[model samples]
Target: MPSSPARPLHLAGTSPVHALPPEVKIVAAFVAVFAIVATPREAIWAFAAYLAILVVVWRIAGISARRLAPRMLIELPFVVLAVLLPFAEGGERVTVWGLSLSVPGLLAAWNILVKGTLGVLVSLTLAATTPVRALPGGLSRLHLPGIVVTVITLMLRYVDLLVAELDRMRIARIARGDDPRALHQIGAAARGVGGVFLRSYERGERVHLAMLSRGFTGTVPLATAPARPRDWTLALLPAGGAVAVAVAAWWV
Candidate 1:
């Protein structure tokens, strides 16, 4: 389970990015991601321009590449798979380093790598700048399915509790002389995972019962209000930049 900190995503500051309405930022992020995805795989210069725009946003949002670097590393596996495409994809082959590689396959791989990186970068920027609580509300306001938003909200709320419980269980196992690092201890680890699931399920049941007793409705009320004009302008900037890049990539 993913860990959740007690504090929401909003950091202490009056940055312009933070001041923008959540809805606008959400839409802008989506537009940027879509533009990145729609760009041609062979359009290397276009990706460079897209990345440059992201860098500007990062600076405006007071986020640093050093902070985002580790997070971006999570995409390495996908990047590696993309790197393999040239060899795996069948097409007209040319000899390189005594091995045949397909031209079309290589281009396909490039496409996935560039687009995937751009998509992840755009999403990371949004998450780094926007509060997690505000995200669900923004999505809801954007006409996303209510149930989907509710599920996300609940998951975010309970994920920390689950993590704490798992930590306690791990400590108990260690105190009992259980060595999870041992090859033979795989079964023990599996059982530990099962126990965590069981405990989480029980906790969920209890929470539901408590909510019912308190007249809890399925909806979680969000504090986010409507988008202001300034918010629209700020959000529009990124979207407009994305469109400009796309047009340049297509025609220039």
Candidate 2:
């Protein structure tokens, strides 16, 4: 495999974490997420331990907190929900600065914000270290349903194509004096969206027909990459750390 496939969000790097196979990273990422989800909200220190674990993994991967922080803004909607929960949820109200808030709701909000942010960061770490090309293989290795794999494979392949088609349509509309920015052109905007959807559907039908004619099997075949020594061992380290965190949360 190339040092880095030129896929969106795949940061090219020479870190040890980058060298690990995609399957390992995927499993490790999921393990860390599971650990976070299993942890009790009261065990705040346990969440801190999980953050430290991620920081260590990030360092090993040559990723920085700065790089991951901005991307985590995608969790803003969840953050908003978290903020609202303290006010909207009902239980054991406490007054703060003349404002009534529920104690349990505050805890629930904190749980959502902290755990959700950590989950986003973990996923971003995996994406930074692994390219999209490797994802299908990794998922297949984990014995994901063939239908699931097939759907993801197709999406990965054609998302860019669909985007390009959309861009071309936008440019053509502009050339024809269709003001996309004009408040008066809402109908045009809707038609453009409808056209893109119809075109995409037609393209998918054609592709499916072509595949069937070409002896396309229902499932995408998994690549048989030979095993590399110590890959799983290295990969499992983070997962083990996550498990340890969970154990500490429960016992301590």
On residues 160-193, what C-alpha lDDT tens digit does candidate 1 reach at each position? 7777787887889899998878989888888988
Each prediction's whole-model lDDT (CA) = 0.80, 0.83
- Residue pair clashes in candidate 1: none
Q: Write the per-residue lDDT of candidate 2 for residues 34-129, one digit (tens) a residue.
A: 989999899999888888988898888788787777678789999999989889999799998999998998999999998998899888889889
TM-score of each: 0.87, 0.86
| Residue 26's lDDT in candidate 2 | 89
Quote the lDDT for 172 in model 2: 93
Q: Given candidate 1, what's the lDDT at residue 18?
A: 78
Candidate 2 versus the native: TM-score?
A: 0.86
